[model samples]
Target: MQENLPRKAACIGGGVIGAGWVARLLLAGVDVSVFDPAPDAERVVREVLANAEHATARLISAPLPPQGTLSFASSIEAAVEGADFIQESVPERLDLKRRILGAIDAAAPADALIGSSTSGLLPTDLQAEMSHPGRLFVAHPFNPVYLLPLVELVAGGRTAPESMERAVALYGAIGMKPVVIRREIEAFVGDRLLEALWREALWLVNDDVATTEEIDDIIRYSFGLRWAQMGLFETYRIAGGEPGMRHFLAQFGPALKWPWTKLMDVPDLDDAFIEKIASQSDEQAQGRGVRTLERIRDDNLVGIIRALAAEQGGKGWGAGALLREHEARLRAAAEPAPAGEPLRLMEGEVDAAWIDYNGHMTESRYLQVFGETTDALLARIGAGADYVAGGRSFYTVETHIRHLSETKQGEAFHTTTQILGTDAKRIRVMHRFHGGDGTLRATAEQMLLHVDMGAGRASRATPEVLEAIAAIAGPQRALPIPPEAGRGISDLR
Candidate 1:
């Protein structure tokens, strides 16, 4: 686990959101102590935890740290005694929430942050009675807290800026994407947008325009897919086409006043209306359990995110990019010390998609990893994309891979690159792969020849390239040559 990730967290409620917080914290390798007086808290927490484990395993490809312990505390004081962070997810009632927040504040350590899972309550009112009110703020998370990465941090009038900073760091370390609300306003950002959409949805239903399912389909099939990667503004910026946002607004902004939307007020939730919505929802679900639906949602989300992640270079364009950044952070946190013997070149996990019928990483994935490591070495030796584009590059001539142990999905692996031998036109290197706990799993020996791609074949002796290789090979010469290096197919067999 990373240093910033909380080691001990106290969850002050055990309903959906509370249990979700527990699931997220525990899975992120944070020990959790939960305090909830409700009789069903134990059962509910265990169920959500169980569901979270499977969904989360599919969500992240990196090897997660061993899950931490969970304990049920009898009272708030018992739970918050030594907690690094405390989160309160009590009922929505303002008085009930204030009492719990105040209790958590009085019982928790001065340094332990106290966050409320209130979706809309003003942090100002919630923290008014707390002892250290500065530590109390709203950290509103979306439902199914184990899956959704967005946690809105709303700092109250008395809240310290450092408190929000710590809260942001803690959430981010747990693989969440957090956005700080500039103002401590009710409903935060996401929910406020959702509320408006919900109001319009209800109005549409009340006017007999669209069924619940119809409305859902309209979003999911079209703009919803686009929104998953690019939000409203960017999605419409493309709509602007050859022109930019200003032209887009000039063309479509007038529609805002067309009275086509029923968004100003919400439709009344009368008995007949409630039943109509409920019946439609039940019909849409078609007897599927919530757990079943959750699994379906997770699988779909995984596919969508993986597709976006494939887009590689971008600034906050998609969840896939965010997922990649998260994995990078996790790898950085879990990377082993270099020990000064070999240069660590690549550290990665067997992504879920790489596993094959044998339940181990596919052979192609091994080559992909080695290829990545070689690319890394090239980039390090001043032969990056720009350099390659200049017509000088190292082209791999041969590779010898020795598969010593089977690696499975979610298994963390790292490679150390050792320059076996180098000359002006050719460089030979051996890459060793080790499991997360330091077991050597595989090895690869590759021979690359420097080429002038614009001219036909082997040509080199470039001063800069030769110097960079010598810089790496010079020190590596002191390390004994690997046993796996220089072996042919006949010799190894």
Candidate 2:
């Protein structure tokens, strides 16, 4: 994780999953170039990227790394020309996969690891037409790739052991848990479990035993809650009390003989059945739409990942080493504004909901804007989880804000922060908000106290941190407080 790896990668296919791979890779600070025959791929990628930013900012406890630049290419060869790794996210058809893999193999470097985002397609089948089959493997990721962390890494019969190891290392570097499938299997791992659950759900719905929403409730409220912290076997073991796994299995084994699952049978995807499922699914989704659902899913994922990481030691310190590396990149990208820069500009656009009744920006949204900027600055100064874990943090003690002008909807703004002054225990900062047109919108001044997180009290800044701040603070001095900010104060005495 300490080593800096190549930050550029290419994604072949700009379909739903391919776009997701692009979003995740870009968020992880890897420059991603996408190739797809679809029209308006660039616009599609931008919209996805924008949505990804909002989801990530809300879901992640730590700051996100600066997103990598996204470029679009007309062909597969152009995209993988200089990429360190290649993610093939094309159609599920075996012929399409083989054709794309062959093209990628011909284009990419001999040593570069190529991953397929196929659900259950065997890597051997996909790589049959590849010139260097050893470099290709299945790297199946769950849907909504930006949020989910699990990646099933399967090596085909032609996939060399060294290629599998290299793929693991590369995926690990980007912060994903790459589980190596001992042998290539259909549906990999997660999908197999999901498909099993889907079958029972479909049977229930088809037989009129339950509605789609009701089935969702059953999983989300019952088994899903238990599955979050402790997985199935462990949870079942606990359910057995002190009896252990053997007893638990023996008790449940009898039920296995019953017709509880359709594991061996496949569902008919005939038109009527498809329509019934789709209509019911649409009803269950309630027209909130894909973007809305994706946001909710990503937020839930963030909460789950954070909870798991916290429980397993901050940042899941060991379970997934690659995730830690990704977290580190995020922390670096979200670093706060340096002191004395009158304005600390952040690079994110306003979401639609932030607009007010007048179609102008809301005051509260302004505060959120400033707050996020401040958080980014603090992260920059190393006042984050890792710093807090090491027992040091900065706490805001006071703030004064003055609104000057109106900001309309969809307008981009920047917050500039200045380091006022610092003493042994306290530091002062001033912030100003400016619209993209360079109009001043508001200003804020604040005081922060350094604290020993373990002791819960004020503390002196560490020399290393102080030096970093000093470097960013530069030589500009804080300006005098304006009269508007002092109006309601009792300090007149």
Best by lDDT: 1
Off by over 4 Å in 1: 313-316, 335-493
RMSD of each: 5.3, 5.3
**Tens-digit lDDT string for candidate 2 (1-493):** 4133355789998877888889888877789989988886677667667777766654443444666888888788889988878999988999888888899999997777899999999988888898899888999997777766679999898888988888777766566777998877888888888888888888877777987888999999999978766768888989777988888888888999997777777667789878888888898888897767876776566556545654443445333233444655655644544444454445444445667888777888777666656655666666656787798888888877777888775566666767767775776776778787878888777788999978888989888778766766655555555444433445656
Residues 1-493, model 1: lDDT tens digits: 2778887999999998999999999988899999999999999899889878867665664546778899999999999999989989999999998888888888888899888999899999998788898888899998788877789999999999999998888998898888999987779889889999999999988889999999999999999999988888998999998887988999999999898887778878999999999999999999998878876776677667767765743222467767656755654555443433566766655667788999998888788778867876786678855687688888899999988999987677778788889888999999888887899988999999989888868987489878987887887788898887878776554
Clashes of each: 0, 15
RMSD of 2: 5.3
lDDT of 1 at 285: 98
Backbone collision tally, model 2: 15
Provide the global lDDT of candidate 2 against the true structure. 0.74
RMSD of 1: 5.3
